[model samples]
Target: MHVPDGFINTPVSVAAGVAAAAAVAVSLRGARRELDERTAPLAGLVAAFIFAVQMLNFPVAAGTSGHLLGGALAAILVGPYTGVLCVSVVLLMQGILFADGGLTALGVNISVMGVVTVVTAYAIFRGLLKVLPPGRRTVTAAAFAGALLSVPAAATAFTGIYALGGTTDVAIGKVFTAMVGVHVLIGIGEAAITAATVGAVIAVRPDLVHGARGLAAPLKLRVDGRLVDAPAAAAPVPAAARSTRKVWATGLVTALVLAGFVSFYASASPDGLEKVAADKGIDQKAEEHAAAGSPLADYSVKDVDDARLSGGLAGVIGVGATVAVGSGIFWTVRRRRTDEPAAAEPSAA
Candidate 1:
């Protein structure tokens, strides 16, 4: 959930900002191993896809709705460190461009939505992968569980933050109960989305899936009432087959359609945090977004009378902008990875 201004006090918000900055700096270095020539560009696509899917909020309860938070999905499709950066990019874009999240609370949103969710989901996913059968199914199952639990975990984190620095005086117990309860329901939707998306990608090009790398291995068999190791499967997939321009183009097209058109049919109800705040009086002190006056504030283009067209255009613009910025950041990181070896060697004598 995107924490808005006036929800958390100045001190906690600043601390969150510092924490967010540090995490991002560390992630940039951590992402290097995960991003190669092929995967670096894919990282941007992952960010763009997350931004698109997040627009399609599904109904969770009578008045509350939830959208794909994308931490687990990103991590499963790419890598954990890159996943954090991907979601953070989306948050920054929403805050400055769409006014979806408050500028003052940017760090809070990044810490809770980006850092907390990615860290928790990735840990659980890796842990589950350890015990489960190594295959596509295991990866999909673990992804579902990781995504399912991360939503409530994020909500719980927000509750704690509120308890410490909530602008309004309220019952921390009630806030925690409501947030955790509804978010648990929301987590079901998150699980479904994460599993389906991860499954689809893992099916088409398992090699492209960073988290599913070690899952597939030599075949095993049972013969003569005894377990036996089968011969190793066919030779490894060629690099040419792994990262094709056609697949990347198809993925980008899919993301564009989801955000630009499909989002129009998404539920209009308030999401988990908004519903909780409205119900529990936690939003009493909520302040207006600083960018409320922006042309594209509230995800609608200024002076666009057609609701569907305005929102669609905004969504498309958001997807494009996110991809561009995310790709730029990842490209820079990839270059760092490329340059390290040359710098490590002695200069020409």
Candidate 2:
């Protein structure tokens, strides 16, 4: 849900900005541990993929549609900290470039869509993994459930935020009920997308999937009629599997295809938040986006006449810019982690 400007008051918006900033700061530090050579680039791809998939809004209800929130998918594919950053990156790009999300409400969107979804979904995912039998199916099932819940969780969060700082006078209970109700339908779509994507990645490169990392049970040996943990073995990494180039290229191509062409077929109805806001009078005070003058505003090129070409070009540009910026940020984070000085071993007495 891209919260537009004027939906929230200045003080509450600023407070949300501070909270979002703090969360990002913490995530950046946590991401240092999560990012590595293999994952850093893949993380960027995940962000780009999320951006692309979000463009394809599926119909959820009569007048409302839903898009991939990307929190559960990202957390399952990468790590939670990086997942938050991934969604944040997409939000940033959409706000500044596409003029989709409002600049003034950037913090509110990030807090509700990025942090809340990632935290809630990842917690549920991990919890389900702990209880469910370990397997690829289990991973996918957990991801589905996590994603299913994350959408409504984010909607509930927005409802709470609105109760605190909503610009218009509306019934808090009505807003909450509507937001959660519509988003619950949206969550079904989210769950399907997340589960399918996670399953696909796990099938191709389970090594790259952070949540699926430990699926392979540790070897056990029976000695003297007692079971003992076998010594860890260094499995040989295939040259092809070791290189993420193929996977990266494949993912980028998929994102390009989706955003550039497939997006044209996406549902044109308002998304869950927009529909809810309109129904509940929340958009009465919504202000125009600051970037409305941008050439690429509203996901269309300014001078391009052909609707398909303009929209496609804008989508391609968005995907390219998002990947470039996301990759740069993740690469820098990865390098910072690797370049740190190693702890020196203590000298023998």
Candidate 3:
């Protein structure tokens, strides 16, 4: 959920800002191990895809809708550290460009939506992957469960933050109950989206999916009444050489369709967090977004009379901006990793 301004006080927001900065710093280092030639490109696509799917909010309850949180999906498709950065990039873009999330609450949104969700989902996913059969299906299942749990976990975290620095005098227990309850429903939707997306990629290019790495169970055959492992095949052509090009092409096209076309059909209802906050009076002190005057505020282009066109253009712009920013970050991380060895050799020499 995009936490707006006035929901959390200044002190808590600043604390969250520090936490978010630390998380990004850690992710930048961790991502070096996660990003390589094959995965570096996909990382950008993952961010853009998350941005696109997030626009298509599905109905969860009478008045509440939910969208893809993308932590588990990104972590599963790429890696946990990179996933945090991916979601953070989307949050930053949405805040500054689309005014979807508040600028003052940027750190809160990043901590809750990016850091909390990625860490929780990745932990559960790794745990499950250790016990389950080493295959794409198991990884997909784990991704689904991880994503489902992460949403509620983030909700609980936000509830705690509100308890500490809430602007209003609402009962903490009620806030917890309401926030957790609605988010649980939202979590189911999140899980399905994560599973389907991860599963699709795993089916096509398991080699490219970071979480699916090392998951290929060797094929065994009986020869002369004895079981023997099949010979490993040559590394199939690089993902870029054989399939990744097509996959990336298809993924980018799909992102465009979802953001530019399908989003128009998405329900106009308030999302889960928004509905909950309003109904429970949690947003009684909610302040207007600083970028409310931005041309793309509220996901609509300024002076665009056509509701469909305005929203479509905004969605397209968001997807493009997210991809550009995400790719730039991932590329820098990848380059840094490459540079480390050269720098180290100079010292050794």
* Better candidate by TM-score, 1 or 2: 1
Candidate 3 TM-score, C-alpha based? 0.94
Q: Which is the better candidate, 2 or 3, if ranked by lDDT?
A: 2
Runs in model 1 lying further than 4 Å from the true structure:
218-237
Measured by C-alpha RMSD in angstroms, how accurate is candidate 1? Answer: 2.4
lDDT of 2 by residue, 1-349 (tens): 8999999999999999999999999999899999888899989899999999999999988978999999989888889999999999999999999999889899999999999999999999999999998988899999999999999999999999999999999999999999999999999999999999999988888888899877955558999999998996688665335989989999999999999999988999999999988888999999989999999999999999998999899889989998999999999998878766453445569
TM-score of each: 0.95, 0.93, 0.94
lDDT for predicted candidate 3 compared with the true structure: 0.90
lDDT of each: 0.91, 0.92, 0.90
Measured with C-alpha atoms, the lDDT of residue 292 in candidate 2 is 97
lDDT sort, best first: 2, 1, 3
What lDDT score is found at residue 335 in candidate 3?
97
* The candidate that achieves the highest lDDT relative to the unseen native structure: 2
lDDT per residue (tens digit) for residues 81-159 in model 1: 9999999999999999999888989989988998888988999999999998888999999999999999999999999
- lDDT string for model 3 (320-348, tens) is 99998899989989999999988888553
In candidate 3, stretches whose alpha carbon ends up further than 4 angstroms from where it belongs are 219-231, 234-243, 347-349
